[model samples]
Target: MRFTRLAGLSGIGFVLLLLGGNLALVSAGFPTPSDAVGFDEVARLHADASDALRLTSALLPTAWLLATIFAAGVFAALWRHDRIRGDGWALVGLAGILMQCVAFAGVGAARLAVATTATHDPGTASHDLGAVAGLWGLHNALFGFNQIFLATALLGLSVSGRRAGLVGRWHAAVGLLGAALLFLAATTSPYGADGVNPLALFGLVGWLLWLVWIVGYSVVLIRGVEEEVPSALATP
Candidate 1:
């Protein structure tokens, strides 16, 4: 009898998590200020702070692992909604995300502390340079790949799952696009030496697309779930 409508309820969580996290990141990201004539005052301070800064910087990807979890969780829910067959796949995806978060938390934290200890402060010239450098590696790229894979799986689930149907398809598509963009984020502009990383903007935009997709789908799915179809025999 507990015919709870998932359309309105849990789906909204998906939207908020994606959107809220993105907004927080954007607002928090002020860029590494570079305007130090001489390292007189800030030099020692920056060097002193390197350890702490490094730890925090390293932990960023770990922080985003939550988003990865959220992404996997969202996709898992989609599996349920779509009535897809791969509950096991969903579980594996979830495990990858959870493990990724837990494993990276401490590791990234240590790195961040170092970065924090290195960079004096954002106001200083060499704000997050070293920290940014640490992120340019295979691990970041691999993690980014995981995000894209999750998105694609969800989109595929949406298309094939009968429960969600057309509405679900659209939802999956948007979410997938968002996840795809996440890959480019690590290598984009700031992370890359090229100065302009398209993936950077695309990643954010893609993630935002996911937020919008979930919100829009929540409304539609709720309505669909609540609707009572009147068959031909019941027509008065």
Candidate 2:
């Protein structure tokens, strides 16, 4: 039997495990955007929010780095082995993860900058969160695109063995669809203060599915994987 991917799978597990840390950062002292237009009122909240974001900033980088390294393991397993099917999926997933790193850092910093710029004057309330809003919208917009890559990657993996080429097509198609919606959210319509957007939630769910699939499939693949004749790799 051909060897599956043990090390790569384990790497994915480790990568996903970092999400717990990220969650903790987000929860530390998150701030709520308020409708109030008073600088003084917003300053308190903004400072509180900034403190939380600082923690989050630290968390996201660590999470992203861990995930990237872990994903590299996946690449080694799927790509090095010329497991064309899984490798394609992994590439797509990697794109999303990388984009997330940018989005998280840019947006987090932007929000923090805005919060810092705030003054205690109530008159400046209207402009107080300018930086915050800029980053908030930009980050969410990127997230919209970023999440789709992950979904496409996962979907690709699920159906890779059956039809590598076909799966690639699906990966591109679904990825495009997810990214498109995100683009729309970022540019045209956008997800404003209109309660939670269902599309955003769906994106998250799709990602979770991919993560779960990867972790589960990884276990099965790892158990069965073994070193084999190098010639076998050249067969198909």
Clashes of each: 32, 1
Model 2: how far is 131 from its true place, Å?
3.4
Give the best candidate by TM-score.
Answer: 2
Task: Report the lDDT tens digits of candidate 2 across residue range 36-103.
Answer: 13334444555655566555556655566655654454444445444464446556655655555566
Error of 2 at 115 (Å): 4.1
Which candidate achieves the best lDDT against the true structure? 2
lDDT per residue for candidate 1 within 21-109, as digits (tens), equals 43443354322221112223333443555544444454455345444534444444446543445445445444534554454454445
RMSD of each: 8.1, 6.9
In model 2, the clashing pairs are 4-225
Stretches of candidate 1 off by over 4 Å are: 1-11, 21-25, 32-83, 86-111, 119-132, 135-146, 160-169, 179-191, 194-198, 217-236
What range of 10 consecutive residues in model 2 has the weakest lDDT sum? 227-236
TM-score of 2: 0.59
lDDT of 1 at 94: 45
Could you tell me every candidate's TM-score relative to the true structure?
A: 0.48, 0.59
Scored against the true structure, residue 171 in model 2 reaches a CA lDDT of 35
